[model samples]
Target: MAALEISKATRRIASTYPSLVLFQLARFFLVLATEMQAVAVGWQVYEITKRPLDLGLVGLAQFLPGIFLFLVSGHAADRYPRRTLLVLCYCGFTLCSGSLLFLTLRGLHSVYPIFAVTVLLGVVRSFNGPVSRAFLPQLVSGKDFQTAVAWYSIFIQSAVILGPSLGGLVYAAFRGPAAVYTLSFIAAALGAMSTVAIKAQSNPRLGEPMSWKTMLAGFHYIRSERLILGSISLDLFAVLLGGAVALLPVYAREILKTGPWGLGILRSAPAAGAATMAALIAHKPLGHRTGSTMLWCVAGFGAATIVFGLSRSLTISLIALLLVGATDMVSVIVRQLFIQVSTPDEMRGRVNAVDMIFVGASNELGQFESGLTAHWFGIVPAVVLGGLGTLAVTALWSWYFPELRKTEKLHSPAP
Candidate 1:
């Protein structure tokens, strides 16, 4: 009887598990693939051009279109079927991968075409971000959203850690860029398939016209949300200045004195740390005094960034990066939970777009800053200075968002 009951439970879970859950997992794999590809691309471009500025330009190329199209992307997400939109977005990304695969296969060493592809990918990502964010609520109830989101973060960070490490290893082992591109294309194709299989009940809006006016409303609403603005700003500035991921290649080659395997370890350290912490948070939500927690997490992240920048030993650097990832994960969970709980279903898409813009700007823009600063002060000093800047930004934000500092409770009821 017990064995029969166990089997029955397994069958029930299999039958009831939302397809969106699987879709999210597949999305994670593609993100992992993309991050891995990015490391390959950045390293390849830097090797060819021998210019730090070239690395910064790669991020700039992606961010330029992202900023221009983000608002419209959000509006479209709000007005359309999110699952279909996500499928289309993955399709576009796959095409970008196809182009890169072609270039690598043909031994094209020119940097311009790579930069162009990066920009094109960014354009597609702008739409993709909003759609993915808005699609989540349709899969689960509000009470489960927090838990679900925590799992989502785990998937994302895990991929981020795994992808670059794998990419570095695969590139080094194969000694050819084509293999990396091929892997990326395969992952992207899988992501599209996952997206296609995602099930959702769509409320189709009939004959709703899109306009700049609706887009402006999203911007206006975002401006009025203090917690949302504060949380996003904290992450933006802190990550922008404290970002150390972009400097991995330099660290791997120079300070670390290790090969591609070492590079993978350095890259994966933070994600590993984040995944561990995310698992803990999923079981126990950060209750009450969330605001103060966010501040301290950002502070810890900044401190870790400084330590990472200053560390000459690979062990020390890995430890510092791990701390940074763990701390940053706390801030991320807080912000995402706050945003999802506060946002009405009608506004989720545009609000998500606003959030994505802030996220994209901080990361890619931070990479540009790191690359440019590295060019000027050399890599170590540049990373150190960025860490200090992050600390300063955290201090300033503490005073600026008093309400956020005092936010003591989130009112989600039991499912």
Candidate 2:
């Protein structure tokens, strides 16, 4: 009887939350396509200029649009039908991949055209990031939302794991990026289709008049909530300093004595670790001391970065990168849960928009920072110093953000 019941429960899971399945599918394909494009661009850019600063410029192009558009993007998410917005965003991504494929196929002499296309890609992502995050709360109810967050994280990490490796393999096998971009275009189109299939009940809109005040509400709310502010800011600074991913292309070419395929594997290492951790958290949520756990995990992330920077062996480097992703997942899960659970449904879009800036800065801007430092200080010192800086930031944030340090629960409303 127990065996029969277990089989019945497993079957029910397949039929449940069909919309959630589509949401995850959309998330997976879009991210997969993006990651594939990223690897190709990084290699292509470095190959053209043979300079680290240009790599930094690539990141800057992607990041600057978000800084300029965050206010408008957040507002659009709240005012527009989110499902429609997502479909449009995915379409934008498909178009971006098509643009890259055309550029690659035409034979590139300079990196300027690639940079121009990346800037266009960045503009689309600014809107997509906030709306995608804001859409999740509506798709899953309050009771299941935390698990949904974990599962969605798994979707993201799984793509990160596969995208670069597959991109790298395709690039090497075909002797260029044309095949990779072609695949990315197809995947992004599928992402659009998947998002179109989702029929989630949209979040209710307040129909508030547009104003600077309304647009900036997300900033004010985050500021007033110390826990939210501290957690988000903590990640912004920590990952900004600790992130060494921008240097992977260089490492694969010069330092590691490898090529594009090796770079792909290195790129996927962190995500591989993150997916494993997310799957565990989905099965069993962190039950206590969420804030403190985050603090410790970030510190671990810093230490891991330091190890990755100093290591010369490929095996050791992969392990260090794995630890980097694993430790960072704790912060990712905690910060996401805090923001989603604490904010009301109406305000989620805008707040997540503000949060996107913080997180995006940590990622794209962080890549730019890494590349700049590598240009100025040489690769090893840049990475090692950044890792050490992350440790110092963690120590100080723990001291300054008493509210964050004292917080014990992951799911509680922020008061």
Candidate 3:
């Protein structure tokens, strides 16, 4: 009887969210390709220059395009066919991976070309981020949206857990970067094909004109909504301060004295933790006190980052990174839920675009920040201080955004 009940529930969810399943499968390949490229790029650049700032430059190169295109990209998502747009974007990614493969084949030593390729990839992501997110609401019913988000995260986290490790193994097995880049190109091509298979959904906002006002509307909506503003800002500042990912190569090479394989493991540790947490959430969704849970989880992320910064032992560092990933996953889910539930369907593209920019800042820009700080004051001190700063920001945000802190549930308020 129990087994039958479980089977029935599974069938119900599967029937209700078929598009989501396709989306996740496509995203899995996309993320896998991207992560493989990341591992290869990080290792190659660090090997050539041996400078931490250049590592940060990798992130900055990827982020700069979004700064310039945030408004335009958001508007495009609203006005364009999202599935077709996504197909094009993944095709662009395949080109980037192919270019990287060519560079590696030519015994390229200069980092400039690599940086340029990353910039082009960033341009693709600028358009990809908003459209990909805005397309979500079209995939599932309103009642199933939150569960879909959880499952969406599970797919992403699973990819994150697998991609880096696979990349590292391929690099090691072939004893070169070419193999990694080759695999990445293949994965990206598969992603594009999978996206092409998804059934098309009509864009309701297709008739909306590209005006200065329309481009700026997303920013205005977020600013007016305290919950949205607070949730997005909290993630921005916290992750901005706590971002230690860009420095992983340094830690793996110098601090932990590990090779590329170890670096891959280190890179995947957080995702492994996050994937575990995401699977749990998908099985049993968060019901109450979500706001406070988000706050605490972010705080835990900071604390874990601090531990990672201070650790010399590989075992200890992995554990710390695992905690960092798990805590950050909770914050990610909660923040995404807030953004999805609160915004109307028409505004999702632009709003998610704005949110993507914030995410870009906290990730790529934050990498630059970490690199700059590490250059000024050694790696350990820089990371430790950043973790401490994350803690401080959490405290300040909790006090300033009492509404976010006091919130009890994930349900959308009446329109």
Candidate 4:
């Protein structure tokens, strides 16, 4: 029955139009490798300094450039060939990874250089977000775009599940942490290569010229689009406050009393959960009441974070982490679908870039918040409070964004 259902779903998608399955697959590999590298960097930095501040610094290193350049990057995406932009971004990322590998292999690395490289990566990622997101419409027909977005989220989070496991294995096999960085370099290079397979026509410009007025127009559009702004904001705060991903190294080392292998499992659990849920969504969508569903998923995510923070047993912690991952995965899918369905074609790039900035900030800033909070009140307390904060934010959003609260079904994308 499951196989039959999957076949039907595939046929349905085929009857509709081709989305960027290949591009999404390549993106999965890129995300998987980068995440592993990030965790390894966290572990290595913490091991060297044994300070929570160092971890926060790592996040700051990645976020500052992205925060500043996001609007410009969005404009560029709308003004250039997305495929070409991606090639440049991935090449830059691959080079960055290779440089780090070289530094590690030569044993000439210090935190300052890592910090510099991370900032560069952040800048590249800013361009990457708008370029990749803007290219989606070219890949699929209007009707299938929402589904495509959901599936893409699945591919992304699924990598999250697998990357850490491989990172751990690679780290253990090499007898040094440096090998993990090399693997990331190889993975990023492969992702860049695969992007060559994508075929897209460039439209570059859509009427207005670049200026401060145009940039402000993008912000203006977002502010006017209540649902889009609200949904993105809700997700930003929920993930920002509740996210403890940055502190996984600390947990693996101190609280959980586990090694690299344990760290991999802890890090991968959320992705694993997300991957599973995404698979299910591909076959059977959540269908209606998406807004309420998203809220519930976030509520679950917050609750799980609290549990994971408080639990002493590794088994219990893993379970809580898995739940957190699973719940957040649902939120991701719903949010992506909502955004794609509602957005106008010309505005997609700018809005998505806006979304990316909020997303990038929430994640990097959340990491900084988690690390500093953990440093001050201890890790467990910090995590628990974050969870509570997420729930509180969700409640506030529910009251404030009535459009999100009352949302029912995804509209078919306009032709």
Candidate 5:
């Protein structure tokens, strides 16, 4: 039944937009390698410093590049061939992965080298993220775009589910991260090739000269659109506080008394949950109460986070994290669909850049916030506090953006 459903979905996508298959392939390798590299990095970094702050620093290093280059990168996506830019970014990823391998081979006494390379990877992502997101809408027809986005997430979640497990297997077999890093490099290089194979034509423009007005267009547009503002900002704050991913290493090592293999399972649980949500969304499109659904889901995400924070048992923790991913997926799909449909193609690069920035800040910067709070307040307290913060943000956002709260249906993309 699962295979048949996927086959039907593939045929539908192929009939409307053939290139999306290749697009999904590119994303698969890219996400798989990235997640594997992440597991390696987390383990290696924690092994070196044994400090939660350094772990947070790792996230901050990657996030800062997106913060400083957000507008410029977005502009480049609009000004350059997005596909070409993406290819370059993948090459950069390959280099970064290789650098990690080199650093691992050399024997590390400090985490500075790890942090430095992560900054480089972050720079690549700053450009790649917005371009990749904006490029997705062009991969499918307008009517099927929402469904495509949901399925798109399925591919991502699939990688999320597998990457850590593979990373752990390799890491345990080798007793180090060097082999994992090598695999990451190989995957990234393949991602570049898959992208080069994409035959779809992207209409990136070079005619628009760089100006303050042109650069700021995405920011201006988002600010003026109240619904857009609410959706993005709500996600920004909700996940910003609700996220517990950065602290997984700490959980596995300290509280859970588990090693890298256990950490891998912990990391993958959320993705496993996300996969369930995406599959459901793909099979049955969201109902009329999408706006209310989104709000409720975010609230559920926070509640789940709290449960995970308070739990000492691995079984309960995994269940909590699963709920966390499931609830978060609902809001994310709704937000992505609404944002993509309402924004014009010409402005997609810029708009999605801003959106990507918010996302990065919520995840990476949120890591820094989590680490600092953990250092100050202790790990369990930090996580519990973040969950509470997410709940508070949800309440405030619901009241502040009734536009998002009362939303009836997602918008259809402009053809």
Candidate 6:
């Protein structure tokens, strides 16, 4: 009788979260497609130009659209049906991927076309981030939100684990970028279809008027919440400095002396570590010392980045990247929980947009920064200095945001 009851309870939990499950599935395919696209573009562009700075240019081009559309995207997410908006965005992604395929098929010589496609993709990303993140809270109750986030991270990490590996294998087998782009297009199309199956939910702010004050609400809220500001800014600076992804091509060819297959392994290493940690976190959600734990993990991430920078052996580099991913996973979960749980439902879209802006700056802009630094200094020095800089930011954040440092639990006291 007890076993029967427990089984039924498990079924109930699963059934009660159908929307969240569907959302995760959609995100999985979409993320996988994007990751594959990244590997293809990185490898192709590097092969064409044989320049490190061009690698950074790719990131910069994608990032520019997000900066300009940050506020408007958030507002649109709030004002529109999120599910519909997401479907549209996924369609846009398909177009971008298809465009890339077309470019490769034409036997393109210049890297400019690739950059143009990336910029279009970036526009899609700017809207997608805010809407997708804001849509999550509507699917589940406050009590189950943290658990939902853990599962969400698991799906994302799983996609990360598979995407680059598949991308590399596809590229190496076909000896061209066309196959990879085709896969990306199919993935994006599927993602859109999956979202179409989700039960439609209404936005709380659907009738709200668009104004400067409304759009900027996210900025004000973050500024008022010290913990949010600290957590988001900490991620921004740490990742901005410690990010080694932009330099992977150089490492693959010049430093690691490996081909496309090796590059895929190196790219997927961090995702493997992150996925493992995400699984654990889902099983047992984070409890005590949430803030301090995140801080320590980020510091560890910096240490791992340093080790990766200094290593010559491929094995050591992979291990370092694994550690980097594991630590960053912890930070990501904690920060996401803080952002989602603390904000009001009506403002989640805008707030998440603001968060995405910070994320874009850290990730894409960080790639640009890494490229510039590598251009000025060699790759090894650029990475080592960035890692050191990450450590310094971690220390400063710990001191400056004592409330965040002392935060004991993930849940907020706010109603």
- How well does each candidate superpose onto the true structure, as a TM-score? 0.86, 0.88, 0.88, 0.87, 0.89, 0.87
Runs of candidate 3 exceeding 4 Å displacement:
1-12, 42-56, 102-113, 200-203, 247-263, 310-313, 371-381, 412-415
Better of 2 and 5 by TM-score: 5
Best by TM-score: 5
Local distance difference test, candidate 3: 0.87
lDDT of 1: 0.81
Clashing pairs for model 6 are none
Each model's lDDT: 0.81, 0.86, 0.87, 0.80, 0.87, 0.87
Tens digits of per-residue lDDT for model 2, 1-415 = 6546534543443366778878999999999999999988998999889997898788889989999999999988888888999999999999999999998878899999999989999899999999998888777666566667878898899888788778988998998888999999999999999998998965568876679999999999999998889999999998888769889888888888878778867988898888877877776678778889899999999999999899888899999998898889988988988898788767777999999898887887687689889999999988998899999998999999987788887654321
What are the per-residue Cα lDDT tens digits for candidate 1 across 54-136?
98788788788879998788888877778888889999888988999988777876899899899999899889888887787
TM-score of 4: 0.87
Assess the local accuracy of residue 295 in candidate 5 as a C-alpha lDDT between 0 and 100.
91
After superposing candidate 5 on the true structure, give the runs of residues whose Cα lies further than 4 Å from its correct spot: 1-3, 14-16, 42-55, 102-116, 201-206, 249-262, 371-382
- In model 2, which regions exceed 4 Å deviation? 1-14, 42-55, 102-113, 248-263, 368-382, 412-415
Model 2: residue 410 alpha-carbon error in angstroms? 2.9
lDDT assessment of candidate 5: 0.87
Indicate the worst ten consecutive residues by lDDT in candidate 4: 13-22
Better of 5 and 6 by TM-score: 5
When 3 and 5 are scored with TM-score, the better candidate is 5
RMSD in angstroms, all models? 4.3, 3.6, 3.3, 3.1, 2.8, 3.8
| Model 3 clashing residue pairs (backbone) | none
CA error at residue 327 for candidate 1, angstroms: 0.9
| Model 2 poorest ten-residue lDDT run | 5-14
